[model samples]
Target: MTKPTEIKALVFDVFGTVVDWRSGVAREAAAFLQRHAPHLDAFEFADIWRREYSPAMEEIRSGRRPYVRLDVLHRENLVKVLKRSGITGATDAEIDELNLAWHRLDPWPDSVPALNRLKRRFIIAPLSNGNIRLMVDMAKRAGLPWDAILGAEVVRAYKPSPQVYSETVDILGLAPAELCLVAAHNGDLAAARRLGLSTAFVVRPTEHGPDQKTDLNAQQAWDFVVDDLNELASQLDASID
Candidate 1:
């Protein structure tokens, strides 16, 4: 393990790492569906919307499409989810409102407090695939104490992409060894580790749902592996108060 003293910044994977996108989206989706399509299942709707996330980003990754912010991909995916649910009469305003559900995601119980503690010790920010506005809205709503937001939109690429990791380290003006990537997903950590960044795997067993089978444990010997952010803070010796 790299000594904690060597890491000057801690960049995070936002969605599913710090926030509970599933429940938050479902909460908003339920209200929207009740008004627009009374027969749809809100949780199912949220799952459907999220299911489109990777393939949409892969289009840009493969050079089949130009890079666009995550909001655009989300809205396009929302349209598909709605259509799949047999909802053909929803107004544009309604769709847009439902789309903002991503911005309103609730943080996991430990996220805010742990982040504030961690912030006292190191620069903390999000290196997510989400756009700047999305991260801002989420941070404000969730009370996350991020020092800055840097990710796919900033780097014009998504996670697991080498540039996303390398460039974010560059933008922070730190060598890869000086920054740590904290995430729930193994692949995200693997990508960061490949680029010489330290990796922390924060377990989020229900990020997918109760039946989730992946990323339940560290798949590799990450620099740190803990159950949640607070534990990570404790390991890093960040004070609770």
Candidate 2:
């Protein structure tokens, strides 16, 4: 562990880490289908949308495309998945509203309180790949209490890209060692480690729903491996109710 004195800030990965995107999107997708495609499975729709996530980011990662906001990619992904679902009669306006589901996700049970506890002791913010608007909206909706919103949009790069990690530390006016990257994804942590940042791995075994074979457990002996945000706070000597 990088002793508590070493880390002055904690940056998080959102989506499955801080917010329960699968369940949140499922809830919205279910209502969407009930009114449109009564036969389509809603949770499956959410999973399919999520399945497109990494690959969509890869397009930018590979320079096959320019840096597009995640909001745009999500909307494009929704259109493609809807066609596969075989549900029709949805207007563009309805599509736009549903596309905002990412902005309305609910936080994991301990996210808000744990963040509040951690915030008292360190600068806390999200280092998500989501655009600024997406993270801002989600924080307001999920009550995440982030000190700042940063990541892909700010740096015009996504996670695992050394740019995002390096630039985020720069933006916070902190050295790489002064900020801890707290995430459920080992790959995200690994990337941060390369930049000399501290790392905390919090297990979200069901982050990918059942059968999530990867990131179900820590791959390396990271600086901190706790059960969840609450425990992470406690481990850092932050008071958590």
Best by lDDT: 1
Cα displacement (angstroms), candidate 1, residue 80, comes to 0.9
Measured with C-alpha atoms, the lDDT of residue 198 in candidate 1 is 94
Q: List the residue pairs that clash in candidate 2.
A: none
Q: Give the Å error, residue 174, model 2.
A: 1.3
* C-alpha lDDT (0 to 100) for residue 63 of candidate 1: 88
Q: Give a tens-digit lDDT track for model 1, residues 1-241.
A: 7777789999999999999999999999998889888888888888888999999999999989999999999999999988877788889998999899999999999999999989988999999999999999999988999999899999999878899999998999998989999999999999899999999999999998899999999999999999999999998894223
Quote the lDDT for 46 in model 2: 91
lDDT of 2 at 240: 26
Name the TM-score of candidate 1. Answer: 0.97
| Structural similarity to truth (TM-score) of each candidate | 0.97, 0.96
Candidate 2 off by > 4 Å: 238-241
Looking at model 1, report the run of 10 residues with the lowest lDDT sum. 232-241
Off by over 4 Å in 1: 238-241
